[model samples]
Target chain A: MSCFILEQAGIDAPETLADVLAAAETIRDAGIMQHPVAMVSGAGWNLAQEFVNLYLGHGGSFFEPGSAAPAINNDAGLATLEALKALTSFSNPDYLTFDSNSIQALWEAGEVALMLHWGSRGAGILSGDNAAPEIVEATVLAAAPTVEGQSRPATTLWWDGFTIAANTSDADAEASFLAMLNGITPERVAANSELAVWLGEGYQPTPASAGVIASAEGGAAPYPMTPYMGLMHTALGDNLAGFLQGTASAEETLETIEAAYVTAARAQGFLN
Target chain B: MKHRTFFWFILPSLIAMILFIALPVGSVFVQSLHVEHEQVLRTVENCGPFGCTEETVIDRAATEELRAAQPLGRFAGLSNYTDRNHLAFSELGVMWERSDSFADFTRRAMTLPFWRAMAFTLTFTFVVTPLVLLLGLAIALGVNALPRAFRGPTIFVSLLPMIVTPLIGSLILFWMVDSRGVLGAALQTLMNDPNLSLKASPTLTWIMLMVYGVWSSAPFAFIVFYAGLQTVPEEPLEAAMIDGASRWQRIRYVVIPHLMPLAVFITLMQLMDNFRVFEPIVGFQAQANATSLSYNIFNYLRGDAAQFGAAATTSMLTILGVVVLLTPVLMRTWRDFNRKGH
Candidate 1:
């Protein structure tokens, strides 16, 4: 969808999804040519290419790619893609790459236009030099795109919470835990921004309980809590690395990684 | 008067060692047994506008939650040392069972990374030790053979790398191995391939790491061997040469035996240093899998949540492994030294 928007906007060339994928392969094989794709992890590289394929496959245009979905199907997918492309190409022609640390550095340097980073990244970026105070002025968080014309974007939520050990001998353990939980309120969330910059876009408060921390702000999407997250993360990271390094074709890499992920999930009883 | 002077001569070093070395080791042992936690609290006065309360106190709890999460007894004996808990078969998928016992937890936490690291450390020790020794011996011999005027400069040059901090050497290696750095640029230019990455392939990563390791280490070995070479008896080598022995034969029979003790001493030092190889591995792994045992230990200790107990157990196991592996060499060296003394 983003590719279609890019094509429609004259940001990306028009080509069929298959042709675009083939072209991406050719470019990848040419290996870090005009602009090296700076993928944060192997999973990211796979997802990026997968996204390009999905966009082109949906009858998206090459020229003004971002306009394709909006023109052909009256969808906002092209608009979203255009927004993302505009973000990536804001300061430079280089494709946006997501390395947790490097992206933080870029944000601090005020070099990044549109950074797709964690909530923590936003915080760090804002705190770095305070050069671009406007970035945090009206920060908004949106779910990532799922498919063309899809109204809801699939937002990735990473839940980190404190759990009390059932056998905790410390008499004050529960009290301390409760205090910490109480400290996680919206006011505390705002205060936390002073300590560390979270992108502040999707800042929300949740119950200080040991479950999924859903957003206090309505319309915020939550991540599914699953036991297989660790394995998925590892597999995704490996595949992303392999793709970025050109060790495997993007399609092959994705298929292999996704299959492995499924097998792991099944073994872990995450799937039957 | 002489006895008093001797005591005075060694007293400073003894005091320094007691203060710097013995004290730190003792402190670490003490710290390992006790759990430490830091809690921050804003006093009513400091809390500005918050009413003061005598009961206002914040306490932080630091305990081993993962182990305590089960109905496991505290400090259970060697029951935690079994196969079920062990990570020896982790690659076989035995260790990944969801409902792991406390022993299994300990095994996974302490044993797996420990053994893996020990194996890597051992491999690193064996590979690097001999190379350093042989290279050092060669350089020492070459320098020793040089005209006395050139020997000083040559020895100084050999000592340069050793004199630099290992961390600095590692940092330099990191830059050199970076894809956009000197060695990578040179390789790219030579191969006419811009995409060639020294860190991308595991084999290449290892090769670069080994090269950096050898480069950083060779100087130390050379310095030791050079110093040892200075003690080599000239008469025996001269006699061997006078007896129509070739240069190689003279070196083989006379010089080598003369330098054997020093060579062994240098080898042992190299082995110890290389076994705990951490800095280079850390630098290398920023772009590649050059992780060594020490680096793994460091990572485990500095992980998101510091698993102190596990870290302690791992450290203990690492110490034990090193002792076990090096015992024979240490004994042999001791016995050889005793025999030579006699």
Candidate 2:
């Protein structure tokens, strides 16, 4: 759930994550907010991880192509996990088990005050009767991602794309299909009710895409891509969960991640 | 002449087994000997005033050429079997030398991912198989004692677990046990702890998974045991009751001996089935707590790049485990057949 606020808070935008947290805490203290904040985990934790990476000024990227080993135990990794704990301090207790859908549901049910989630899921909140009724038309998105030391909000850029089968019978037809998808007119966007696609190249952000769009405008770095990225995701998600559950200390958790990656890399024939 | 005719009649089944079972197994064994290919990359180092910098590049064309020559990459010659993820003998060796006691060594070794999966697999099979048999037998005996009119509905209701697909069944159980769901809420209130989650502890998660396994498979056992109960001759019950035997004695002496064959059948089939448990791990989101050999194979085949070699090795090992589990049962059946013929 990304923060949605009416202009009545006497603020143009939340300048940092702290601003949103402080405001939520104050409102919660005044007995105003029901659900303080809902943090998403499981696959949806990628968004939170990337946001924390930005906030912590992580000096290294795990997904860089050809990087031989993971730097998951580094200072940036530890700092990001610490920051993640703070961000989710007031979240739903079941956040460990929450996928993107459940977190989105929390926000939709009006149980959550704010959350950082995909704009697609968050868009319904700005509609009728789902959440804080007063902010139906008053919602404002933050313009940038916030970095720990940096003034701007840094985010990793991401989007889903499509491809055609190389063995298609008609190359001409496939090429035309690609062209039609790319060259959709505003009329087409309206007719199809396409929210995620480029609307005649002006790049308007839907409620679902707002967090990501803001990150892009703020010059968020591209998401990391490495040979063992799938393994890394599994390693990070599984081990980081242990730390969250307090089953293992942060150091032991990081060590577990490092060992897992090494073993996986060896299995994949990346190492001797 | 009868035997020869029977051979001709079974020729198609033999051919089917060769093609479907033997061929796939043979291929897996071969694949295990060949490692999954990695993109062959060549590195370049540029010397400069600022200390030489190195870069690695995937030589796609060269890789394709190399692949074209030996398609499955290099012949691993059992090296894949010995690799850290598979045999893990080397890691075990390292842990063994460092640890003081056998218990300490096992604890360290179980931390290895492969060994961890093995522990879950063995635990699930041994635990669930008996559970299915016991629960099944209990339900069968209870239902059998009921009036004839009620037996039909009870049997139908009992078989419901096997009716749904395993994955769907597991998902339903998972949702019901979710910390926010009804059962989870009930457990929390019962324990008087507001935040008790079944998934919080590794031991609790494993126990929950095993319980789900038994609950899901108990019906199969119940049905089999129910069918076995029908064949218990009325004469034997009359004889046992006339001998002044109690109801429990009648079951222990007469009913159980008659049900031994069906029990053996269930044991053999269930051992093989339970040994390959996979779905509940995904449903329970217990990949962090438990993993079976089948799940271990799936892990290798799951990503952007499938490590088919590791999957193949795990598959072969899984087949070996199933074979080992079956051997005693097969020998017992053979011995019983010989005694009957004599």
Candidate 3:
């Protein structure tokens, strides 16, 4: 969806590595420098790095922040790299680290050119009468792009859901639990959207709740919750923090992160 | 008759001890051991139900495979200990390798959180104790000297924080220190700087925490010292004043010594309380700069995998650190108690 919009706005949307490089050359040739890109802090960092490497590999430049990134190759950093790979390969390359609070500030200030953020953050940007319209204008979800001939855009769903613990003693609770799960009706979902607005702007319900949420106001894609989510988050956060701080090169960061994920998987009994 | 009386006297306490203290401690110890061997025990138990049954005979190979896959063992030996190798070392090798030696684990465990907590505890004790002591003493002296009509109101004012719940006090502090809070706004207004947010900078955070700590704690000290001041012999203060001593001299020479015992008591109590500073820090911002040792231990214990053995080790180390730091002051108090013999 983002690619479609960008393409309509005359921005060439690249799907593959080779195409991305060609797009980079075209942009550079047109004397239009890529502006600052926002990345979610922590696990999002690794994804950002992968994205950066893909871009840089195709002849793009990265904007280094004030602090020197740390030197990586630590076990933790390697784990982060691995976690990033396991999650998604379309890591946003040119990204800046921002927590929810920092992102809110950046969005309000219109400081960031692009942001790859949770759908809920949009509600926050829209909330409070004082919120700047420019933030709403600038914000766009990072949807997966289709290659030149592809018809549909791929959207990742980030979902937070409830599950019964294996050790839950009350077997009878399942009926009530299923009822409660089903109770998130369209009305309830719309109410939740309002509640999210009250809580903070940029808050959006999961995509599954979108049909219900769309009735109230702002809503977007809900990222899926994968088993490797936590590991990916931690790895990305640590590595990206390291990269932004200038401690690790993009390649070293990615490689080290990949190794770390392998180790973590093994430790968790997921790998042989 | 005396034996019967002694038995009656001891039995209640004995039962209470077994039911409350002893039972809980024993359970915790067992739980600690289980935590130590968690993985192996899980693996073994995953095999099948404990103690084979007739049903197991029907599918021996399947059950055996299931059991192997599950892992079942009452005792996992050092498997649990090995997973916690990170707690021992500042930097472990990048590979997923367990520590080769228990000695390394023991050494690392002793230093990281244990020593760091100790240092924080010591700083907390030192900073809060003397400040509370002096402030409390001053409030006590002032209250004691107040006219009889105003005395009650003043004492009540000093006792307000003590009467209010600590949790509530912490909440109040949280609001006050919050960037969008009233206190933050007041500070910003007074400083005439819009950008000066309390929670943003480390220095401001420390100041806010310290102020909150003193505000919530000074009252207790004030109440104790005020009571102590009431008991101070008036004759010495009168004598000092008659001897051409100024108010400062009279306080320095006469009042402080008279209040020494009470001061020592308050100091010891405050030292212990401040060393275990937990709730306030926890209630403060999630990533606030006010992390004390107790909070760190609590956070570590509350992680996804509750590392009880690690928690126990950390707890023991914290106790040791406190004892080491407080021994000298405790000894002085002991001597003072013996001398007073009350």
TM-score leader: 2
| lDDT, candidate 3, A26-139, per-residue tens | 443454433223444423333443433222222222211211122233433343343333222222221222355654565465543334445456555656354566445544
lDDT of 3 by residue, B1-342 (tens): 599999998999999999997786665444433332112111111111122221101133553564475442134333332332223232334312444677544333322334434545566677777887878777888888889999998888778877778777877776665544687778778899755656545456556566667777898888877777777787887888889999999888887887787777777677778877776665554222345667656754552334455454445445555677678878998887789765
Which parts of model 2 are misplaced by more than 4 Å? A1-37, A43-57, A63-67, A85-93, A124-147, A150-155, A161-178, A185-194, A197-200, A206-208, A267-272, B1-6, B42-57, B96-111
- Residue-level lDDT of model 1, residues B293-322, one tens digit each, is 566556535422343433444454556566
Show where candidate 3 strays beyond 4 Å.
Answer: A1-118, A121-157, A160-272, B1-115, B179-197, B286-290, B339-342
Measured by lDDT, the strongest candidate is 2
Weakest lDDT window of 10 consecutive positions for candidate 1 chain B = B42-51
Lowest summed lDDT across 10 adjacent residues in model 3 chain A is found at: A61-70
Chain A TM-scores, candidates in order: 0.48, 0.78, 0.50
TM-score per candidate: 0.56, 0.85, 0.58
**Model 2 C-alpha lDDT per residue in residues B1-342, reported as the tens digit of each score:** 599999999999999999999999999899988864555666776442223445555666876787898876668798777867767888789879978999878766665667888999999999999999999999999999999999999999999989989899888888888776789888988999866778756788889999989988999999999998989999999999999999999999999999999999999989999999999987876776677899888877866667788789899999999999999999999999999977
Q: Write the per-residue lDDT of candidate 2 for residues A1-272, one digit (tens) a residue.
A: 23343232333345566665665665466565534666556522353354334433445466334555766677766766665666566665556566677776666555665665544554565654566664444444444336456644544444454456555679777787878786666566655442563424455556545665666566555444444566666566545665665656667667777777676666565654
Error of 1 at B194 (Å): 3.9
Distance (Å) between predicted and true CA of A189, model 2? 5.4
Docking class of 1: incorrect
Which of 1 and 2 is the better model by TM-score?
2
